[model samples]
Target: MASEDLKEDQEVSFCLNLFTLRCGHSFCRVCINQVLNTKEGSGVYSCPECRAEFKEWPSLQRNVTLCNAMENFISNNPQQEEITGISCTYCVHSPIPAIISCLLCESSLHNNHLRVHSEEAKHVLTDPSSSIENRKCSIHKELLMYYCTEDAACLCMSCTLAEEHWGHQVEILDEAIERKKEKLSDVLRKLYMQRQKTEERVQRLEECRGRAHQKANREAERLNALFTDIRNQLDDLEKRMHCEISRQEEQESLSISDLIQKLELKKDELSRNIRSIEDLCNMPDPLTILQEPDMGDLCDPEEGEGEEVTGYVDDPEQEEADEDSKGDTGGDYGFQQILHTLSNIISDVNVVFYGQRPADILLDVNTAANNILISDDLKTATRTDKKQNRPETAESFQCFQVMSKERFTSGRHYWDVEIAESGICWVGVCYPSIDRRGWQSYIGSTNKSWSLFIGRGYRNQCSVSHNKSELMLPYQIFSAGVRIYVDYEAGQLSFYELCDPIRHLYTFTTTFTEPLHAAFCVWNKYVKV
Candidate 1:
């Protein structure tokens, strides 16, 4: 009997049985079939769990025994039974089948029930004699006479007339139920639209999150690369710093050793010189042991006979000789020579004298020949006089010739002159004529024996003397000689050798102050003697 009951239970459980694989897994029949059909194989099936290969395997088949066993377990446990009660569909009271249908109200009930019931039980299945109606009214206990649409039921005449339902457009229960169902459908449609909007918002947020995650990953990679590069640079810098420091230390050590060697050599030389001087002072004179020499007689008593006398040589003679020898070698070595050499070296680096600059002169349009005027300041001379001199010729004078009626070119030119004898002299510029005749010249004092001349060519020439006595000429007749002078404010004088025939002569009156009286003559006919 137990075996039979088990078989029956198995059949019931199998109605909902599912298939499972040999891997100790289970699924529905449809799910297993899908996996098996899609798997690639011909002769053998591989165990999904152990991945073990097998040959000559049978096709996939359901396990009937297992299915039956599971179905049997299900069938043995049956559902529980439910208890039911009978009552009127519209009323609160229990109903009985003893009474027949009512003729006045169309209701059923058992006999011996109340002749009239409450309004709530008016629609129950009861006999007509027991149906609820007057006794007064079911609700208010008064007689029912009117029907009210607002109240949705039959009411007493007084209730209909009352304010509660006087003017309302209310309906019966059936109409109210229909109206509520329509409103519920509209609310459901609106709720479905709101749900769709919420789903769209969720999808957009997911996309944004994906993009943010990708950006963060890329930034992390970039930072990692930068860190690696910085580490490499720091390593290289450390290596270079070590090399530089080692090199500098080696150079400093070498320089210090060389300086120490030079100082030691100088100290040794000084020590040797001191020792030599001390030894010389301690030596004794060899002349101290010498004997006295004899001397012959001074006057002869007779032509043939003579007497001799001698005195000891003085000891001071040896000392005086020693002192004289020491004077040549003692004291500082090459002191004067060292001073001279140092002075020469310093002089080579110093600037002592500078050469003169040639004057720059231009033509003066106003000055006339022979009566030419000198510069007022005497620093500059102009051939022509104007109210305010032009800058090009303001600092120097311009030369002109009355015969040529022309001016000299703007440039430097040189000339020389000499005194016939030792005397005061003056040199100046001479404007030339068209026929090369001298028209004008300027003269000034040779304040000293020598002076300087500076200016542009024939335009202007300035002569300054260095000695007051040299300005007076000793001879009236003199010969031409070369006198070279710098034509600017530079202080220098040069004399030229003169070989022409001229002689000494005396002067009557000499004036170094004025140009007219300061002239030195050149002999025209014969050499003065």
Candidate 2:
């Protein structure tokens, strides 16, 4: 009866393959199939435990819940115990689980047994494991106590005294483990700090990118607003010109209309005067003609006004030419106005800012390279054939280079340098920390400096270089020399050729971390700033 009850309980338990009947009862597929096969010919069958009736033809649906639960249960339970692992030897009678093992006794103990276990320095307690044989030296059959530093392995006392490890450095196994743990902890701390620093650098880079995007957006917005205003102003200027021409046209038309009205009245008066004269000449009665008013009345006192009207009507071409003459004058006037306003607008857009630009930039003698001669006023650097007797200093340059006395750390600054008309030279900016020897010290060859190199030939090919990368600038004529401008905080360096209208030569951009000084490299010529 007990076995039958247990089997019934197994029908609804979690298993690998399970299926549910129409009545919501679950059972393993194997057991359900085995029981249904017994009633194969019967068309219907009854559930084993619930006794629920079901058609033999009913489709079986796999129970997914039971499959998943079965997977988890099997993975975590019924694990085969390791035969070599230590168990509760002291708990042999009770057979309780072992929690700790004693190396001195080679036995595992439970909590109650450990309360009465021997308390000795040699009794090393640890997690219950089958390490009795592993803990001892296979050759000596003795428990390994000391650690051999030379061989990086555990050693038994007998092995430590033997010929193999005779004079090698050794420490207690417990002490060695502790020391290793301490070093590991220290290394872990350093790794954590390194990770923190990396995170901070990443965040800083992201912020820089955000700020750059904002700056670009602001510049675009400003330009857009400015252009829109310019367009509106241009539109207003055009409207004002049209209005002026319209006013001129209106005034000329009104004047011509008034003259035409006067001409019509004068024509009627001239016609009446002629008709009266013809009547007086046709009359035969001299007395009747004499009876008319005095000669002043017959002649008409307003005849002079009519003569003026007749003069304007006789010169039709002249009248037409006179009309709207002021309209042409107004057009000329608007043209001058348009030209003047455009010139002013252009000046405002490209307004030259000469603020804080040093007029006289002096050279530093200490940083001058070999054979470089500085003028007494320190404004000029000349490359001489004869080397001057100067003491070698840390700040001195090894090549044909020189630096300015003035160092720029912040704000915008620009200085003009007059280069030799025909010679190879370099004009750029460099940090004070530039290398003092080898090719790296040459201007434009290292990351610490930026330079523009002008060639010796007629074309005077110019190239800008930084960190060993060079970009050749399109050849252009230079009349005066070159101008160097630097915005330290903005990390912008620009070189402009002092030609007509001051053409921009090149520009370099970077994040400057140190103060910068103007750098110059010249040979076979002199440069003045």
Candidate 3:
């Protein structure tokens, strides 16, 4: 029983030495010394367990009963605390009534107040010089006394007197602090609004990116489809080109085969003709052997002469026939007959010559309508017939005649006459003036003698003849004449003679409707006559 009591006492004694020096609580000397030395120059020696710091070491008066009790209690209950009251360092009269104490002033205070005392009272509040030095004026070196509302800062008394802050209302520090707080609140509200706008812009950009991706995907798909179509078209084109080439090759091959076949057939026919000619040359010539007589056999017929001694003198006709037979022998009858037959065939074939043919003319005897009027300038040698109802202006004229058999039989015919004055002549062939090839001429001849001959055909060749007679007269008579020719067949025109066969001459005539000078404005311009 005594040993058990002694062990209990030993346990309590071990715990009592574990308090810290900073908090006036017993602890291991080594543990307290490590904490005190870590913060040696800070004037704060803190307890490791309770974080209680002291400026100086407390009196080491050991409380025997309490320390033993605490030691036993801590050993049994490891988390127990000692509820000790502390005194305030700043107000010595007030009891701190807390577990911690201020290390700097060596006065007891609350655990929380111990930290505040060093920062606010011991270091900053106790040093009046540092406090005044830290409160520097923001604008000037003078000590700040007032705050400017407009400048949003503390200003020295001298700065407040400046002209820049003349109209601005000055305030104390308390009031400036309140205003700055309100302004900060406003700035925070604006920042929130700007944040919302930025968020909206980001959302729009995200949507735009999504749309761009979709469009790019669609374009890629379309391009792929187009490429596929192009490939298909190219394939089809290749097939068509290949087919065309094959067809051309087949046609060319067929043409070559046909040409080869024709050549082979021609070669076979030539070979057969050559063999037949060789066979004909090999045959013997009977005429050649018959012409040669056996004269030796006739002289050696001694035995045969006795048997038939009726030999008489050869006839001159027989000798002459023998001589003639010798001369006619070896003649080539087949070759001569072949040559003669070939020559006859060639001679019998007709040969044609190519050139022009003679000309022939045809004339149509037709009358004009009664309504048309003839011109007045026309010359009339004799008025065989007259119409009472004809217009006096003579705008048109028509005449018709049937030729006799003698006139038709004439090979070539022409008319020669001289015009007394300038006039227009309307020539016609086959039909009336409507059918003639028309011509206009300015007459320059007085008593001009002209000759018109039958051309290659029956067509009349009209020209402006200005040749005048050399005979001089008192009155100048513009005599221009034209000749008319008749052709039974239509023919081409020639200068003076017939052209060739196949050409025919045709009959033609001319009539004057009006005076040439009046109808063609000949009076405006004069020609040498």
Task: Give TM per candidate.
Answer: 0.25, 0.34, 0.28
Write the candidate numbers in order of decreasing lDDT.
2, 3, 1
**By lDDT, is 2 or 3 better?**
2
Instruction: Give stretches of model 3 more than 4 Å off.
Output: 1-111, 114-145, 150-153, 156-168, 278-529
**Model 2 over residues 187-273: C-alpha lDDT tens digits?**
988985786566456546645764664566555665565556567778999899889878866776676677778878778987897
175-234, model 1: which lDDT tens digit per residue?
555666788768866865675455445435544654564455555554454445445544
What is the TM-score of candidate 3? 0.28
> Between the candidate structures 1 and 3, which one is better when assessed by TM-score?
3
Question: How would the candidate models be sorted by TM-score, starting from the highest?
Answer: 2, 3, 1
- State the displacement of the C-alpha of residue 10, model 1, in Å, after optimal TM-score superposition: 25
Best by lDDT: 2
Residue range 225-338, candidate 3, lDDT tens digits = 544644565576567656765775676567656656765775686677567555545659866545555434423434323221111113678657665664565221233433
RMSD, every candidate, angstroms: 42.5, 25.4, 47.8
Whole-model lDDT per candidate: 0.38, 0.74, 0.39
